[model samples]
Target: MAESAIEVLGVVRPVAQVRHMECGVVLRASDAVALTRAIGADELLLRVVQRVYLLEQRCATLSAALDALGASLRQPRAQAGAPNAAPLEPADASGVASEADAPQRAQQVVRCAAFPRTLEKRATDTLHERGFLVRPSNYDALACLVYMHGFYCVGVATKEDFGGALWEKPRTASDRAEGPSEQKRARAVHGSQQLSEDGGGAAVEAAAHNDSAATRMRQTSAPVCRAYYKLKELGSRELVAFSDCSVAIDVGASPGGWTSYLAERGCSKIIAIDPAELRQTEPPPPCVEHLRQKLQDALPGLLQRKGLAADLYCCDMNAAPSLVVELFTQAVPLLKPGAQVVLTFKNVYPKKRVWEAERDAQLDRLRSVADDVHLVQLFANTPRECTVLCRAKQSTEQ
Candidate 1:
């Protein structure tokens, strides 16, 4: 594909060559701080900008890179105020940088999440040699030198630059999981702020820095299953408000990955319907009721329970499309209008156009009974897999 840049930024960007879009990080060429502010304003571009680092230099050695970085901020500004009034060396950044004001904003610890573990040690050593004391925790790092691949990305960032940041991959500090795709953009964002459902400039900016959302499905603790990350992102994105949700229904909930997430999100009651066993069954959560039967068999008894109307329904079944459609149609009456629905289209497996056709049929079936049917590719999902999201439109009483 041709090297390109979006119309708004006016800067040509290089898209990373990665298998999945979620893992592919795009590096943008920027000239001014205003360019970064522009990216924060664009929602579509925000997804690609998981992290933002002002690239001071990409030197052959870590020491050389730090020397170059110090030189840039050293520029004598007659005004004696912000460091960025004069254009900083635009390395390979395409996204946001914290606005310049206080001088201490530049204090950053040195770090890297790229491959070749040696690079991380080398960068830290070089920073230490240069008098940058190692912080006890990544969160305590006000800002830091971040290395990716062989590129030396160092610069000044905000105080919370490293605080509560998902700088390292889960269970390890290595970036091997991200591979070379981690080197996509020039500007880097620290651990991104918590996700916000309320969309606007702030949310876009916050999300731009948080790679966790872009990476999707990161659990702070051990997960029941990989599916935990999907629902985690859902709550992070505000697609499903788990905090307000009281009752949730999990269809085909074997091994209870989705059900486990529902309970973690604070759902007061989760009815997991599956023929097999859930991993959560060892002790079984008090909040969960396991109905070990098919959706069709368990649904009738499930509905008769007093004062029960589920506010959320999640269906992740690996069965025939028509059968799923049949079961969902039957269960649609159990929801009140405005209830949220999430389903995984396992049929998206690559076989040919046949799978595509199957996915399309399911889309049509969902749209007939639900409002705002949105097809989304969650970060936790494989390239061939996707998820269907919608809200119930009609009530059973009607």
Candidate 2:
């Protein structure tokens, strides 16, 4: 039947003798089959293309709706090429060094002032006012964040990020040890009676050197003092009077920063109390007695047995302000009538509104027991916490 169909589709062809006409019916039939198959394939492809187009349109509509709904979306944009941003070079991995002729890289020193605080806005403002730029090297940014949000001291990167850069002066081993020693000798010689007998020019020269040395010392010490003073300012202010020779109690004294400050000012004796050991592991300060116990447990007995009464009781325990205040209230009877108590309250718990309200209430309660109270908000305080300086109200004559 297939052979008959092929034969029916063919036409006569011209041979060697007999004349034959060729219609190419078989070829035409094959061409028709190919055309029909192509048509079928094209129709299938067209349907696929249409489906794809419809899917794309649907995706576009869904994307637009999401955008309108304010869903989290990221728009693609070209990356910015800032002029100041430079690519970092890989470190020299090879151990070899060229001795004959080598280019010496110049080290540039940068000076910066950082104020560590919690409020970024405030810290930025303060830095701007002080003529500092907010850059990658500036730790004041982190400090500001810390100040605004209370964080543990362990996470503080001030020493790592800001300290090294701010004070990166190269020094030799001998230079490091000898520099201060020579300074001391020079000062001693200048202040000696022997120097007094010298020529006026020598005296003048000595005075100039002394002044220069003093300036250098002041410059070197300024940053530490600045930070400390800022912290002190931020802490609540109460009348902290230092008598010529008097006893004081520094509660929650870990590193003994405050106790050392007091001792330097000629406080005869200081009872440094803390659960943690003081950082100065070598020895306690000459006048300081280290009490390795919680303040609550040791305070009452120590006061009674020793018959010791402190003129000033400074508490900087990191506990909640309310607890510190309550402790103070309990220990008040142990304190002399006219003695002054300085306590630092840190509002560490979350819910600032509730903390503030509770703090104020505690302060109000303290007023009923104490004579007169002065409450001052320290500028050094970050948003997380504040220092409260309290004094006992006793008779004016007492």
Model 1: how far is 45 from its true place, Å?
12
Clash totals in order: 18, 10
Worst 10 residues of 2 by lDDT: 50-59
User: TM-score per candidate, in order?
Assistant: 0.52, 0.44
* Candidate 2 residue-wise lDDT, 74-156, digit = tens: 11111111111121111133311222122322221111111121122343343344333433221221121111112111111
TM-score of 2: 0.44
Best by TM-score: 1
In order, what lDDT does every prediction score? 0.55, 0.41
Error of 2 at 260 (Å): 1.4
Q: What tens-digit string does per-residue lDDT give for candidate 1 at 173-212?
A: 1222233223222222232222222211222232223444
